[model samples]
Target: MNIEVSTANMKFLECFSSETRVRIIELLREQSRNIKGLSEALGIQPPIVTRHIQMLEEAGIIRSELVPATRGMQKLCILQLGEATLNFKRPEETHVPGCHRTVVPVGQYADYQVSPPCGLVSGAKRIGMCDDPRYFGDPERMNARMLWFARGYVEYRIPNYLVRGERPCMLEITTEICSDAPCSTSETPSDITFTVNGRELGTWTCPGEFASPHGKFTPHWWTKTQYGRLKTVRVDGSGTFIDGVRTSGMTIEGLDIRPGAELRLRIASLDTARHSGGVSLFGSGFGNYDQDIEVNLWYDHHNNAETGS
Candidate 1:
């Protein structure tokens, strides 16, 4: 029988030694306070509070910041550690499990073989529905599409665990996305979405325009078409979020790939009512996000999480 534990659990056990560290956590749980604020409230000296704060920061139990205050500058701190527990193993180690198979981060894009009912669009405004390379830059066309049924799933292999026999129970895949250029901003929300395994994850209604959340203004040309308003919707509730907000859906769970597994993500404007105005996906070559569509998977020793069981 095999049992496993996570790195997060050990860190918590290590913190139980210091009472000062524990009190700081209790205080921060109420509100974020600066060093001076903490000293005054706890009736401790600045240097002592600073020392304990340093230890907690090193332990990953809390984080600190230097923000301007009306009176002067101070180091503001907050606790980030959450509820976690650990299971103990005997000190006299018996059989040691060797390195586990792991999945490394990789990039994913569209590949074509047999698009049952979908198509493709190229840069410079050309749409390819059952298209040939000749449609690469057709002025009348401006979208790329490809599709299939039963075999509809696209493939993206993720080698989540890097060792020999370890498997992962949870899989996290994150990517910033948008697809098929819509004729108008109002039409951008109708894109259809799916995973590689023929499992219908869900759909995301993108913002009418791709706007930069970083405060940097989007370029003029891209504004006409919804190209800069980057919006992400999760496929599974367990997926990671982008811009610390959007997340991917259940692309894979209880994942058990050794080297890697093909990650297939397919997009279609399936909302017939809105997709009737079909759109074009402006990947890599032209967009403010300044990157081609990317997908990241997070897993451990064995199978995937949501799909792993």
Candidate 2:
């Protein structure tokens, strides 16, 4: 739902310009409604309502499907947009140099030690039996789009592409994650820790396991968990930050990062944590935001020999 004010997105931006469409968005926000229902509510004919629905659908703001009803079937319109962000600023990469971006699938974890209520699922089907820790080692896990665990940790190794004389300036990792629950409830909270190269970055307490309104990209057949909050963990020269707010004083320098050094990332919900509500990770096909774990490494091409360059 992120967009910029540009001609390229004129269609999406136009969706908000009409009064009927705005009312339609508001109506769908409450719940999915049939075209006839919306037509009656808006005090308009079904033909006009259908036209508005078409606009919204073409703009990717809403979705429509036919369902069984008293007659034959009814066109049901569902709101797909949960949130929208208008970016006024330019992209960071446009101004920053010596930056490397990598996308790692959630199931590609190099190491893991997870407890029960754990399993992996691809976009199509479940990888193995649920609540079985052994399935984490399955070769099919590489195709997994989402995974959850009641306890313990999962680790990933990101290859550093920096060459000699390129000093690591900052590291950022973004992912969609939430507390793990049997199904899903907004009450549970989990203290999740992020570690880079064995150096603790910080701990973020995810509010809950979310399941309402459904994820924009989550498959229809999958119904265990709906979506997760997007989180960004950043480490720079000054400190570590979660979503722009400083969480810890751990700096990038402390990690002993250097050219050609492999970055190991660990996400853990330790048993000793105060709120051990478990963890669930969503990748491309199973979350509101359709993306995998994204890692951005910003560097400076300077001869910082002190950093072992």
Candidate 3:
């Protein structure tokens, strides 16, 4: 997760300030623990542990759920974050040039051709029957927060707002995704390909389907899949990169993207490809990250074109 290193994020930064809170994070990382278990481990009173847990939850560093215990119920706390990147650069940094950002929901795809073991769900309930490709066309799909498929492609159309003299320098797409394995297993790997404007950008091999006791934002009733890793695919003058690691020789210029051009992004799990496990996409209220698929386009003046970071 990326967070600005500003006073506005002191809430999250403060989590590491106290030794007690830091120790709590360390314990939670190994495994989920209930409040009673944590209190005993820390040798602190239950009220004190509860306060630390509250702070962690408010900072989005941890999540907790109420589960039935031997007597009544216990609050089980789980670590929510794997890693965090502190962005020191300010948002208004002028050296970065002009940029535009757009967020598209996982279900707001312009086109799709998926196979069975596919379905869509909102935070509350399922949109249609599971493993039925026909449900992809459901009218209520626009409200979907999570979607999965065994194979095939799902495409989204990104809006292009570049005016006359803006030269495209970079395009970045960020989303939470994973392999769509049956029975919610994480052992499968899938080679997912990405395309922009019909040009293949690159293929990323997803490690596997990710699961947890519960997602930070996902509802408790739903448990088929848990969460996914957040990935950022970037295309620039030099090459295409996934999370800053160059994955292909494809460049922004090769995509033919320009002012007022239609930007169609397609994600596919072709059957012919090696490790064609599947694909699962998570949006706001469905994954650890409370966000939709985000796209950012950075540009420079035609007269002063430079490489993008």
Candidate 4:
């Protein structure tokens, strides 16, 4: 599970502090086991293993189910979170001086064009009927925490929230996303493009949709086999970048994000792409990152003052 360290439950932290408990977690990572199996594998007493299991369960790190055994019922222990990250730094700790930031949930897109094999879901449940294009216009889409489409784009209107008289010098967008394949499995490559204020920023080719141990925060009710990888795309004076690597020749000037300009960002799986594998966007409580799509606008207040319009 992705947990902010500052606000993490004390009990959760305590679960990781003991060596025995850590070993238990390691063993479970290989596969689920009963208390007897865990004790035998770890060479610990049955009562000691039971105690550790209780602590892990209380921390939401593991869960147990009773299974019919040859003699009687046996409790099987399984790991709940496939991964976990403790973010020790707070938002302010990593804040840029001249940057204004905003976060938009994946489902809050202002406009969209999607093909079939598409659907929307909140953290708890599906928003509307799946695979039906009409549901894309449903008002409940605003509550969407996750959404996927086989092709087309989702547009978002980002408010220009920078200081007065300051124009953006750079823009960065980060989100956890993956290719949307039929049945959530595909090895096909898809070129995902990004546009800012109608200007083509860049395109990144997604290798494939991932599967295995589902996303840590992904709800149990949802039946998806895999989740997205976190990605950060940036546009600046030089060029566009994905995860700090330059991917496009397009520069910040091409976008023309002026002080009063209406800011809009669009993510698309173009029809002509080499791989029309589709796309899935994840938000809080839906993806591995446990965050929404984040946009950061960096500007120069001093430069604005010197211009003196």
Better of 1 and 2 by lDDT: 2
By summed lDDT, the worst window of 10 consecutive residues in model 3 runs over: 300-309
Q: Write the per-residue lDDT of candidate 3 for residues 42-73, one digit (tens) a residue.
A: 99999999999999999998878554355664
Q: Please count the clashing residue pairs in each candidate, in the order shown.
A: 80, 0, 0, 0
* C-alpha local distance difference test of each model: 0.43, 0.85, 0.84, 0.78
lDDT of 1 by residue, 1-309 (tens): 132254655444556677777787888866678888788888889899998888788766677744334455356786655333333564345343233322222123333222233344334432444424333334433232211111122334433334433443333333334433333333344444544444545554443333322212223333334343233333222552322233344434422234444444554445443433233343444444444434433233433564344
51, model 2: CA deviation in Å? 28
Q: Which ten residues in a row have the lowest lDDT in candidate 1?
A: 144-153
Better of 1 and 3 by TM-score: 3
Candidate RMSDs in Å, in order, are: 11.7, 9.1, 7.8, 10.5
The runs of at least 3 residues in candidate 1 whose Cα sits more than 4 Å from the true structure, single-residue gaps closed, are: 1-163, 169-176, 179-182, 185-188, 209-251, 254-260, 271-280, 302-309
Q: List the residue pairs that clash in candidate 4.
A: none
Q: State TM-scores per candidate.
A: 0.40, 0.69, 0.69, 0.67
